[model samples]
Structures are given as structure tokens and as C-alpha cells.
Target: MRIGYFLSCEEYAPDQLIEQARLAQDAGFHGLWISDHFHPWNDAQGQSPFVWSIIGALSQAVRIPVTTAVTCPILRIHPAVIAQAAATSAVLHDGRFVLGVGTGEALNEHITGARWPFAEERLDMLEEAVDVMRQLWEGDFVTHHGRHYTVEQARIYTRPPAAPKVYVSAFGPRSVQVAARIGDGYISTQPDADLVKQFRQFGGGDKPAQGAFKGCYAATEDEGVRVAHRLWGTSGVPGELAQVLPSPRHFEQAAQLVTPEMTRESLPCGPDPAPYAEQLKTYADAGFDEVYVANIGPRYAEFIDMFRREFL
Candidate 1:
């Protein structure tokens, strides 16, 4: 199976980000998965750099392809802008850019004072946004009037040699159906055989699926668990932040529920390659062609090496 490294978006020096990408490439990682966020999930999380700029830098520094694990174009930015960014990045990377998108959360989506839509409405907006982006990227004059966006007399003259592939992040049935219908590929954190089958059933074709999992990588199992809790205990449970604040600092309040002990129980942080490889295999077993591993601690390069040595 092909493997990718999920670069941490939480606070880091800019040079560190570039260095991490370079290190991942040197370690034989196939691609890079990045996060898109205006703010870190919590104050303790520290930095959330502009991902596009980082991508631009990675285009020059690394030989591997890069994709935003998922960006919310409809909410944080317009589809036109996203299309342009993707096109530009693809050209810069010599056609190694993929676009992954989702409907997004109020935490990041509400920064523009826009009311967060219900799940169904958000899906509608996403569908329209994707269509608009695709139309604009075809290198033709475009005019679109839909429920969410309207574009007129615009064409992307600097289009890439090939259109960048669009991937959708789906965790629910309706979202999965949307992904199958609209996206070139699908992304999720967990491996679900049913979701893969559903994607094919809905005309998703034989495109790739990508999954992400988080934990700390260390020389000893105990150290890994301790670091995992320190870095990601706040995110241990699913659906806990369906209604949280707008900034990473706010996560600290909720993160109180996530203790070191809880993190050890919840995340796959161990010296043993067994757990890490097993977690990745769940996605592989479910037929994911690629699985991206997101390391939760400071030892980003070390985690990449661990995965490369044991699995790749």
C-alpha cells in the first residue's frame, strides 16, 4: 500500500514545516497530507500557518505530491479562489496536487459571521461549490448561477496541463453518497468496508481512498502513550466538538475532559509496530489504496521513519 505523511498544522516555526516535508521525502514517504485551518484547534496547540503558502514552499523543497487532507472551500474561501490555488499549486508541483474538500465546522466556518448551515444544507452548498470549481477549471469562460455561488465571464487562463483530482471527506452515509457522486476520490480516518462499497455503488469508479490516524511515535510504548495524550487527548472522542468554539484556545476548556490516561486508552501510541501497522491495515483491509499517518507529537520525522521502516 502507498503511504503518506500527515504534516501537523498546529503551531510550529515556518522553517520546521519545510524541514519536516523534506525529512518525509528523504524517509521515502510517497506524499504529504496537510491540514487547512485559520486557527489551531486549541490555544495550547499554538500555530496554524497559512497552508497554501506552505504548499508553495513544499512544491520547491520536496519531490512528493501534497494534498490538503481536506479544505472547506465553500465556507472559508470561495470556489473560484480554491480553484485558482489548486491549479497554481499543481503547475508549481509539476502536476502533483490533489484537492480534498469538506463542508466544514462552525469553528472555522463562522469566522466570516456567516451562520453555519445544517448538515443537509451544507451538503447542498458543497455540491454546488464543487460543480462551480470544476466548471471554472475547464479553461473556458464560465457563468454559473446556483443556490450558493454565481460566477460570470471568468476563465482560468493559467490552468494546469491536467485538472487536479478532487477528493471528498465523508464520515456519514449522505456525505459518502455525495463523495461518490461528485468526488474523484474519498477520504476518511477510519476504514469502513461498507463505505468503500457504497462509493463504488454510487459510481465513484475505482478511484483511490485515503485514511488518517493520529498518535505519538516513540522508542518505548509508554512514552508514546504519554505524548499522545499530551498532544491529542483533547481530540480523543468523536463528535465531542460538533458544537465548540471558533479558536484552538477554546479547545483547552473542552480538553480538560481528555486526560493522559484517557489518551492512552484511546490513541494508538506504542513502541510496538503491531498497533500502528494494524490501524493502518484496517483501512487497507477495507480497500483503501493509501493511508496517511498523522503524528500527534513533536517527533514528526521519527514517526515517518517508523512507518517507512516497518510498513512501506
Candidate 2:
């Protein structure tokens, strides 16, 4: 399985992201995964730069492929605009860009005061959004008036020779089925073998399925746990809270129930690269074609170095 580095926009500035991309490329990471978010999960996690701007900078920073670990086109941004942005991005990256999309979280998409829809409605909207984007990417004027969205006389002029692949990020069965039908690839954070099988069985066929996990590289496991808990405790937020929470304050409140032990158990933490490698092995066993890793705190450089020396 291919290993890539996930640049967490929720925790890094644009320059830091570029630097990490450079580090990951130098360390032989196969590709890059940069998140697209309007806000950090909580204040402790800190930063969320405009992802499209960062992607533009990344085109100049590295040669390996880059994907938006996941972008929500159903809300926050219109599918028409996202189509143009993605097209420009693909052109900038010389066709090495992939647009990984999902039904977004309220924490980011609620800024426009749109009521957060239920997961089923959101998935339906995602399907329509993907349809709209594919039409625009055909390089002709498009006018779409669907149940959830409307676009009039829209066309993407600046585009790569081929449209950027749309990889769907889905967590549930219905969403997975929609992803299999529409996505050129699959995206998930878990290494669930059954879900991977369902995706292929549903319609994904031989398309790539990507998996990811988070880890922290610290001098000690305890320190790693502390950092992970402080910065990304929300990673432990259970169920639909992550999908429904509307603000960082709400996420912070939910994160209070998460303990350091929970955080440590959920992700690879500490100085050893072995746990990280083992997690990758698990994804491989689960049938992932590619897997990415995100360093949960400030120790990303060390984590990337160890990966190069020990795992790459």
C-alpha cells in the first residue's frame, strides 16, 4: 500500500503546510492529503487557512500528487464555484490534483447560517453536488436547477486536459453506496474491511480507496498523549457530534468528556514509529490502496523523519 502525509490545515499555517509538504516529499511519502476546513475543531487545535490558496502554493512546492483529504461541496461553497476552483487547482498542479469530497460538518458549513441537514439529506445533496461539478468540468456552460442547488450559465474555462478525480468520503452504508456510484475513488479514516468490500461490491470496482489515521511524535508516550489530547481531543468525540456541532465552542464542550487515554487509544502516539507502521499494516490488510498519516501536534517533522528512516 502507498503511504502519504496528511497536512492538517486545522493545526498549521500556510507556510507550515508547505514546509511539511516539502518534508513529506523529501521523505518519500507517495502523495499528500491536506484538509479543507473553515475552522479548527477547537481553539486548541488552532489554525485553518484557506485551503485553495494553500493548494496553489503546494503546486509550486512539490511534485507528488495532492488531494483535499475531504472538501464539502454541498455547503459552505457552491458546487459551481468548487468546480472552477478544482479545475484551476488541477491546472496549477499539472493534473496531479484530486478533489476528495464529502458531506461536510456543521462546524464549518454553518457559517452561512444554513440549517444543518440530516445525514441522509446531506448525502443526497452531495450526490447532486458531484453531478453539478462533473457537468461544469466538461468545459462547457452549465445551468443546473436541482432540488438542493441551482446554477445558471456556469462554465469552467481553465481546466486540465482531464477533470480531477472526485473521491468520496463516506462513513455509512447509504453514503458508501452513493460514493461507489459517483466517486472515482473512496476516502475514509477507518480501516474497516467490510466497508472497503461494500464499496467495491457496490460499484467502486478497482478504484483506489484511501485510509488515514493520526499520530503524534513526542519524546515520550505520555507527552504525546498530552499533546494529542490538548490539541485534538475532539478526535475522540463520539457519534454524530462531530458532524452536527456548529462551532468550536460546541466541539470544545464535547471534547471535555474525552480523556488522554481515549485519545492515545484511538490514534498512534508517542516516540515509536512502530505503532504508526502497524496501523498502516492494518489498513493494508483491510484492502486500502493508499493510506495517509497526520501528526496530531507540533512534532510532525520528527514523525516524517522517523517514517523515512524506519517505514519508508
Candidate 3:
């Protein structure tokens, strides 16, 4: 099981992002995962840098592989653009860039003035988007006309020897089935063994699967909760509606239910790295090829060092 970390969506300046990636590599992390968000989930947690620019800097700053933990290719940006960007980044990194993608949420997708598609419609769109991206990445003159996308004699000149691997971010049966059928691999936040089995059964082969969890290396649980709530309190919301809401402010509104007391339930925070390693181990044991850790705060260098000593 490979260990990596999620650069926080909340804290850290642009340069700090690359510096942390460098630190993760120096500490022997196998890869780095970064989130793609147009807006911070809340004003209290305010920082969402353009992730592609950060990837460009990381191409020069670190030797480890980097993946967008999940980017939405179907919306905000066209699949053609995503295909081009991923191809270039993969080439720049000498084939160390993996493209982790998903259907995306309203917070980011609705910005295009397009109505947010229903869940089922979103799945269909993702399927078409993936098809379009793969076609364009092949370096052929693509002339595709699909239900959700259309391309006319489109060609991506700087295609890598092989396209960067496409990893699907899925959390449900339908999505898992789509990932297995089309994706090179699978990515999920929950390390559910059954879901992994479903993906493999559906056709995901022995290719890599990734899992991510949140943790904070702090002196006390209280500190960890403060940081965790500041970063990811919306996990406590009871239903999917809150998650699919149109704006990040809606998340902040729902996250009000996530008190510091609930933070213990949401994150694995402690003075030592044992809990972090233990949580990550669940993903490995579930057969994930890679396990990503999302530090709840800007303790990247320190957490990388401590986690390496304790787990890696």
C-alpha cells in the first residue's frame, strides 16, 4: 500500500503547496493527491488555489507522482481541456501524473450557468465525458458527436506515449460499475472492501485503487477537532441533499451541526501517527493500491516525517 497526502483545500499559500509536495517526497511518500475546488467549502476555511497551476509547479518541485484527488471533466472545463491538461502534465512529470476524476458537485459544476444535472443524468454525462477524453487523448483526429459532448476533428498534439491513467472517483453502485467498465482504476474516500470487490467484479482488474482519510497531528484531540471542523465538518450532515447543494455556503450552513464534539467521529487526530497509519491500513487491507492522507491543517512536512517514522 502506498502512502500519500492531500494538500489542504483550506490553508497554505501557493508556494507552500509545492513545498509540502517536496516534503512528502523527501519523507518517502509514494505520491501526492490534491483537491480541485472552485470555491472553499466555507468562508471559515478560505483557500482554494487553482489546482492545475499547483500541479505545474509540483512537476518541477517533487519526484513523486501527483493526482487530482478528483477533478470534474464534464463541467466547469470541457473534457477536451482536461484531456489536454492531463496529457501535458503527465508528459511534464515523465508519466507520474494520474488523472483522478468524478462527475463533480453543484458547487463547482453550476458555475457554468448550466443547471446541475440529476444524479442519474450526471452519471450518463460522466460516461460520455470519459469517452470523449479518452478519444481525444489518443492523438487521433477525433470527430465525436455524443449525447453530452461533441468534438469536430479535435486532436491533442502533445499526447503522452500513453495517456495518463484515468482513475474514477465513485461512492455508489452505479458509479462503481461505470468506473470498472471504463476507468483504469478506482478512487474513493471510504475504504469499503465490498465496494472494491464490486469494482473488481465489474471489471476493474488488479489496477490501482485509492482511498483517502482526514487526520491531524496535534498535541490534543481538542486541537484536532478545531482543525477538522474548520476543514471538513460537513461530513456530519445526515443526507445526500446537503452534499449535492448548489453552493459551498450551503455546506457551511449544514456544517453548523458538526460541533467540535463531533470532530472525533470525523477525523483521526492524535499526537502520534499511529491512528493515521491505522486508518490508512484499512484501505490497504481492503486492497487499495494507494492510500492518501488529507492533513486537516498545514502540518505537511511534520506529518510526513512523523508518519514515515511510524508507518512507512
Candidate 4:
């Protein structure tokens, strides 16, 4: 499986992210995945720079292909706009960019003051948005009047030689089906073999499947767990809470119920490489074509070095 580094926009500044991309490429990582968010999950995570600007910088900084771990095109922005931005990103990356999209979360999309729709409704909107984006990427003047969106005489003038592949992110069976039906590839955070099977069964065929996981490499497991808890404890917040939380403060409130132990349990935290290797193997064994790993706190250089010597 191809191993990539995941850039967390919520936790690092734009320059730091660009630097990480260079470091990752130097360390022999095959690709990069970046989180696209309007806001961080909690105040402790701190930063959420405009992802498009960072992608532009990444194109100049590294040769490796990059993908938005997942961008939500259904709510905050119209699909046509996302299509244009993605097309521009592909041009900047010399056609080495993949567009990963999802149904979205209220934490980011609700900021536009639109009511958060149910998962089924959001999935429907995602389907329509994908349709609109694909139509726009064809480089023709198009008029679309769909249930959730409308585009009139829109054409993307600055498109790349070829449109980037669209990977749909899904966590459940229904969404997996949606991804199989509409996406060029599939993306998820879990290493569930059943989900991959479902995706392949539903026409995904030989399309690429990607998975991601978070880890913290530190001098000791305790330090890693502490830092991860401070910054990413929100990760342990269960179920639909992540999709429904309205703001950072709301996420913080919900994350209060999450303990440091939970964070440690969920993420591979420590100096030992065995656990990290084991975690990554789950993805590979589950049939993922690629897997991206993210370091939770500082010590990124150490993490990359360890990855080279131990995991890579």
C-alpha cells in the first residue's frame, strides 16, 4: 500500500503545513492528505487556514500528489465553485491532486446560517453537488436546476488538462454505497474490511480506497497522550456529535465527556513503532490502496524520522 502523510489544517499554520509536506516528501512518503475546514474542532487545536492557499503553496513546495482528506461542497460553497477551485488545484499540482468530498458537518457548514440537514438529506445534496461539479468540469456552459443547487450558464475556463478524480468519504454502509455510485474512489478513517467489500460490491470495482489514522510520536507514551488529549480529545466524541456540533465551543462542550484515556485508546500514542506499524497494517490488510498517517502534536520531525527507520 502507498503510505502518505496527513496534514491537519486545524492544528497547524499554513507555513508549517507546507513545511510538513516538504518533510514528508523528503522522508519518501508517496502522497499527502490535508484536512479542509472552516474552523477547528476546538479552540485548543487553534488554527484553520484557508486550505486552497496552502494547496497552492504545496504545489510549489513538493512533487508528491495531494488530496483534501475530504472537502464538503454541499453547503458552505456551491458545487460549481468547488469544481473551479479543484480544477485550479489540479492545474497547480500538474494534475497530481485528487478532490475528496463528503456530506459535511454542521461545525463548518452551519456557520453560513443554513440549517443542518439530516444525513439522508445531506447525502442527497452531496449526490447533486457531485453531479453539478462533474458537469462543470466538462468545460461546457451548463445550466443546472437541481433540488439543492442551481447553476446557470457556468463554465470553468481555467481547468486542468484532465479533471482530478473525486474520492467520496464515507463512514457507514449507506454513504459507502453513495461513494461507490458517484465517486472515482473511496476514502474513510476506519480500516473496516466490510466497508471496503461493500464499496467494491457496489461498483467501486478497482477504484482506489484510502484510509487515515492519527498518531503521536513522543519521547514517552505519557507525553504523547497528554498532548493528544489537549488537542484532539474531541476525536473521541462519539457518533453523530461530530457531524452535528455547531461550533468549536459546542465541540469543546461535548468533548468534556471524553477523557485522556479515551484519546490514548483511540489513537496510537507513544515512542514504540510496533503499535504504529500494527495500526497501519490494519488498513493495508483491509484492502486500502493508500493510507495516510497524521502526527497529533509537535515532534513532527521525530515522527518522520521514526517512520523512515521503523514504519516505512
Candidate 5:
């Protein structure tokens, strides 16, 4: 499987993200995945720069392909607007851009004060949203009047020769089927073979299915665990809470139930290549075409260097 680096928008500032993109390219990583977030999950993460502006900077910073590790076209931003932004990004990156999208979480989408829809409702909205985006990308005047959105006379003026590929992120079987039916590719954070197989069986065929995981690198295993638990104990937040929690405080409250051991058990940590090796193998065995690993703390330079020496 191709190994890439993931840029955590929730953790690093804009300049830092650009620097990491450059460093990742220098490390011989194949591509890049960037998170899009309105808030940092928790305040300790301490940053959430405008992702579009960062993407523009990244085009100058690195030659590696860039993908939004899932943007939500459903709520906070209208699909028409997202389509234009994505088209411009594709042009900026010389068509080395993929627009990875999902139904999104209340944590980011709730800020517009629109009522959070149930899972079934969100899935319905996502399908319509993608349809709208595809219409806008065609470069013709678009007038869409769908159930969840409406766009009139919208045309993307600055588009690449090809529309950016849309990769759908899905965790459940129903969502997987929807992704397979409408998505150009697939995205996931888990190494679940069942979900990958379902996407292929349901209609996705041999399109790319990218997977990712978070990791922490520090001076020692214990320090890595503490840093991870301190910064991203939210990773241990179970089930739909990640989708339902409306704010950082709610995540902070849910995180009390999570512990350092939970973080350690959940992700690869510390300096050893053994755990990182296992992570790569698991994603490969899970049938991922590409896998991206994200650093949870501040030691990203070391993480990329370690990958260059061992993983690359």
C-alpha cells in the first residue's frame, strides 16, 4: 500500500501545516491528507486555520497530492460553494487534489444553528449535496432545487481540466452502499475489511479506498501516551458521540471516561517501528490502496524522519 502523511488542522497552525507538507514531501511520503475542522475538538489542540487558505499555501509548499481528509458539503458550507473551492484547489494543485467528503458531525455543522438531522436524514442530504456539487463542477450554469439545497445559475469559472474526484467517508453499511453508489472513491479511519469489501461489492469496484490512523511520537512510550491522552483523548470517544457532540466542552465531558491506557491501546505510539509497522500491515491487509498516518502531538519532525529511515 502507498504510505502518506496526514496533516492535523485541529492541532497545527497554518504555517506549521505548510511546513509539515514540505517536510512530508522531503521524507518521500506519497501524498497528503488534511483535516477540515471549525474547532479543535478540544482547546488543547489550539488551532483551526481556514483549510482553503492553507491548501493554497500547500500548493506552493509541496508537490505531493493533497486531499481534504473529509470535508462536509451538507451543512456549514453550501455544496455550491464547496464545489467552486474544490475546483479552484484542483487547478492550484495542478489537478493533484481529491475532495474527500462526508455527512459531517454536529461539532462543526451545529455552529450554523441548523437542527442536526438523524443519520438517515443526513445520508439523504449527503446524496443530494453530492449531486449538486457535480452539477456545479460541469462549468455550465446550474440551477438545482433539491430537498436539502437550492442553487440557481451557479457556474464554476476556474476549474481544472477535470473535476476533482469525490471520495466518500462512511462507517456503516448503509453509508457504505451510498458511497459505493455515488462516490468516486472511499475514505475511512478504521482498518475494517468488512466495510472496504462492502464498498467494492456494493458498486465501488476497484476505485481507491484510503485509510488513516493517528499516532503519537515522543521521547518514550510513557510520555507519548500522556501526550496523546492529553491532546486527543477524544480519539477514545466511542460510537455516535463523535457525530453528535455539539461542542468542545461536550467532548471534554465525554473524555473523562477515557484514559491514557485507552489512547495507548487505540493508536501506535513512541519511537519504536514495531507498532507503526503493525499499523501499516493492518491497513494493507484490510485492502487499503493508501494509508496515511497522523501525528497527535508536536513531535512530527521526528515522526517523518523515522518514517523515512524505516517505513519509506
Candidate 6:
């Protein structure tokens, strides 16, 4: 399985993200996956730069392929606008960029003051948005009027040599079906064999299936768990709560119930590479073609070093 490093935009500045991309490449990571978020889960993790600007910089800073772990095109931005941004990104990356998209979370989309749609409606919007983007990427003037979006006489002038592959992110059966039908590949956070099987059976076939997980590498297990819980406890929030929470403050409130023990159970922690390797194997064994790992906290260089020596 190919391994990549995930750049958590919610926790790092633009320059730091670029630096980490460089470090990831130097450390022998096969590719890069960067989160595209308008806000951090909570104020404590603290940073969220415009993802497109960072992608532009990454084009010049690194040679490896890059993907937006996922971007939402239906809410805050028009599908036509996202098409243009993604087209530009593809060109900038020399066709090495993959546009991974999803229905998105209220934490990012609600900032536009738009009413957050229910999950089924959001999936419809995502499907329509993908259709709009694919049409725009064809480099021909296009006009489209769909349930959730519209585009008129739109075309991408700076198209890449080839259009970037669109990967759909899904966490449930319905969304998985949508991804199978509309996406060139599939993306998810979990390493569920059943999900992978479902995706393949529903038309994904041999297309890539990518998964991601978070880890915290510190000198001691306690130190690592402490940082992971402080920065990513929101990850332990159960069910579809992440999809509907309207703001970082709301997420912070919900995250209060997420204990450090829960965080440690969900994310691999500490200097011991054994747990990290074991966790990653779950993704590989689940039939994921690629897996991306995000390291929590400030010791990025050390984590990369350890990853290269012990995990890579």
C-alpha cells in the first residue's frame, strides 16, 4: 500500500504546512493529503488558512502528488468556482492533484449563513456539484442548471494536461453509492473492510480507495495522548454529530465529553512505532490503495524521522 502524510490545516499555518510537505517528501512519504477546512474543530487546535492558497504554494514546494483530503463544493462556494480553483490547482501541480470532495460539515459551510441541508439533500447537492465541475473541466463553454447549482457559459481556460481525478468521500451506505456512481475513486477516514467491499461491489471496481488516520508521536505515551486529546478530542465525537455541528465553539462544547482515554483508543500515541504500524496495517488489509497518516502536535520533524526509520 502507498503511504502519504496528511497536512492538518487546522493546526498549522501556511508556511508550516509547506515546510511539513517538504519534510514529508524528504522523509520518503509517497504522496500528500491536505485537509481543506475553513475553521478548526475548536479554538484550541487553532489555525485554518484558505486551502487553495496553500495548494498553490505546495505546487511549487513539493514534487509529490497532492489531494485535498476532501473539499465541499456545494455550500460556501459555487460549483463553478470550485471547478476553476481545482482546474488551476491541477495545472499548478502539473496534473498531480486529485480533487477529493464530500458533502461537507456545518462547521465550514454554515459560516456562509446558509441553512445546512439534511444528509440526503447534501448528497444530492454533492452529486450535482460534481457534475458541474466535470463539465467545466472539459474546457468547453457550458451551461447547466441543476437542483443545487447552476453554471452559465463557463469553461476553464487554464486546464491541466488532463483533468484531475475526482474522489468522493463517504462514511455510509447511501453516500458510498453516490461515490461509486460519480467518483473516479473513494475516500474515507476508517479502515472498514465491509465498506471497501461495498464500494467495490457498487461500481468502484479497481479504482483507488484511500483512508486516513491520526497519530501523535512524543517521547512518552502520556505526552502524546495529552497532545492528541487536546488537539483532536473532537474526533472522538460519536455518530453524525461532526456533520451537523455549526461552529467550532459547538464542537468544543460537544468535545468536552470526549475523554483522553477515548482519544488514545481512537488514535495511536507515543514513541512506540508498533502501535502505529499495527493501526496502519488495518487500512492496508481493508483493501485501501493508499493510507495517509497525520501527526498531531509540534514534533513534526521527529515524527517524520521516526516514520521514515520505523514505519516507512
lDDT score, candidate 6 = 0.93
lDDT string, candidate 2, 136-197, tens digits: 99988898889999999987889999999999998889989999999999999989999999
Candidate 1 lDDT for residue 1: 70
Please list the residue runs of candidate 1 whose C-alpha ends up more than 4 Å from where it truly belongs after superposition.
none
- Candidate 4 structure quality by residue, lDDT tens digits, 151-220: 9999999999998899999999999999999999999999999999999999999999999999998889
List candidate 4 segments past 4 Å from native.
none
Native-referenced Cα lDDT, model 1: 0.82
Winner by TM-score between candidate 3 and candidate 1: 3
Candidate 3 ranges with C-alpha deviation above 4 Å: none
**Model 3: colliding residue pairs:** none
For candidate 1, the per-residue lDDT at 242 reads 42
What is the lDDT of every predicted structure here?
Answer: 0.82, 0.93, 0.83, 0.93, 0.93, 0.93
Query: Model 6, 1-312: lDDT tens per residue?
Result: 999999999999899999999999999999999999999999988999999999999999999999998999999999899999999999999899999999999999988788999999999999999988988889899999777787878878999978889999999999999999999999999999998999999999999999999999899999999999999999988898999998889999999999998988888899999989998899999999999999999998889899999867
Q: For model 3, what is the C-alpha lDDT against the true structure?
A: 0.83
Residue 235 of candidate 5: its Cα lDDT?
Answer: 77
User: Listing every candidate in turn, what is its Cα RMSD in Å to the true structure after a full C-alpha superposition?
Assistant: 1.7, 0.7, 1.4, 0.8, 0.6, 0.7
lDDT score, candidate 6, position 283: 98
> In model 3, what lDDT does residue 168 have?
95
Q: Across residues 147-249, which tens digit of lDDT does each residue of candidate 5 receive?
A: 8899988888999999899999999999999999999999999999999999999999999999999889998999999999999999789999999999988
- Model 6 worst lDDT window (10 residues): 146-155
Candidate 6, position 312, lDDT: 78
Clash pairs detected, candidate 1:
11-47, 41-248, 42-248, 42-249, 43-248, 43-249
Query: Pairs clashing in candidate 6?
Result: none
